[model samples]
Target: MKVTVELSSLNKDDDKIFGNIYFEENEYAFPEKGWNDFVIIILNWWAKSILKLLKNISIEEELDFMDGPASVKVQYLKNNSFSLYFILNKEVVYSSEVDVELFTKAFLKELNSLIRNIKENRWESEEIYSLMENYKMLQKCFIP
Candidate 1:
């Protein structure tokens, strides 16, 4: 039960992001083919939802992929476990069960990677700054 993310491309001019989310062997691509979207909003939502899950204050969360018309829904199960569903066009495309601890660790690692990527690319924008801040907050609040 591992989760990882790769932020492959960032369109600074449009503030659109392209990325892949890997849940073990499954890969979910953002902005789904032939479409592009402003992904920062959903990334921020995901980070905040993770915070709530870690704090045990929320049982479920659904995040839309903006113009992509895609989403990932998370349902918290007992004892640090969760069910994850990837939906495209309001249809469930993929689903998996994961351990939150492992997912968080991988998510944090990906966030660090993304931060480095942003700095190396010298992409500066208010939206990127806000996303980084959200990631920082999540890292700070995560216990493991």
Candidate 2:
């Protein structure tokens, strides 16, 4: 399937950093960051995870985004195949074309591991705790 992830203006310009994933159709686009702030940092971590995931899946494609934070739309083939687009920095905006059940299972597993690691390490500094609380609050806007 052709999956494309477009970056917004908030992200930067990188001619050589395009098409870093395994997608059929390819294009250039911009991204934007919505309500939640510190999008860049959040996406930085998210991008790393995506890169690692894609490697594990043996998908070859390109990924491009501005140096800052931005929003994105992840699209794919198969007549509206599963895809995900969301603001990583802002409460994790997500759009998906994958199977909901499977995705949920995998996502929850990974998230649980991440949360457990954070808790075990006691990495929640005052500032980080503040951000985590804010993120939790932002999640309420969608989860409920």
Candidate 3:
């Protein structure tokens, strides 16, 4: 399965960022219509969760997109594999098995792109800075 993440439409004024996750044909978009989700909080949580997974410190992790009413629950399987359950409004929207290495690659790629976009747009904020710190930690510890 192909998994990828996209982040865009950073509204500095309202402190919201719009984004979507694509797992092959499955798509999960956040906030639906308004500026309700905080970009930094979501991204930081994701980065930290991924870090824990990489370190084999957590067998399961659940990421909740605050105010978006969406979440992703990741459960580790044997031999660098995981089960990903995408939830929307307390229901499972999609679920699939994913290779940990591939998922990490996709996540890191999108994260790099997000950092570049932030720099290019000059959209600096405290929240953004905190997220960057978390990203840095993730990068330092990531193996592949």
Instruction: Please report the candidate that would top lDDT against the real structure.
Output: 3
Task: Estimate every model's Cα lDDT from 0 to 1.
Answer: 0.69, 0.37, 0.70
Q: Residue 107 in model 1: shift from native, Å?
A: 1.3
For model 1, the superposed segments whose C-alpha errors exceed 4 Å read 1-8, 14-36
Off by over 4 Å in 2: 1-81, 85-96, 126-144
Cα lDDT for residue 3, model 1?
40
Candidate 2 per-residue lDDT over residues 1-144, each given as its tens digit: 222222221222221112122122234222421222333344334444443333344232223344434444443434423365544455434444564334333433333443354466454444335435443433333352
TM-scores of all predicted structures: 0.76, 0.30, 0.77
Candidate 2 vs. true structure, TM-score: 0.30
- Count clashing pairs, candidate 3: 0
Local error of candidate 1 at residue 140 (angstroms): 2.3
Q: Give the higher-TM-score candidate: 1 or 3.
A: 3
Count backbone clashes in candidate 1. Answer: 0
- Against the correct fold, how does model 3 do in TM-score? 0.77
Which one wins by TM-score: 1 or 2? 1
Estimate the lDDT of model 2.
Answer: 0.37
Candidate rank order under lDDT: 3, 1, 2
Q: Count the backbone clashes (under 3 Å) in each candidate.
A: 0, 28, 0
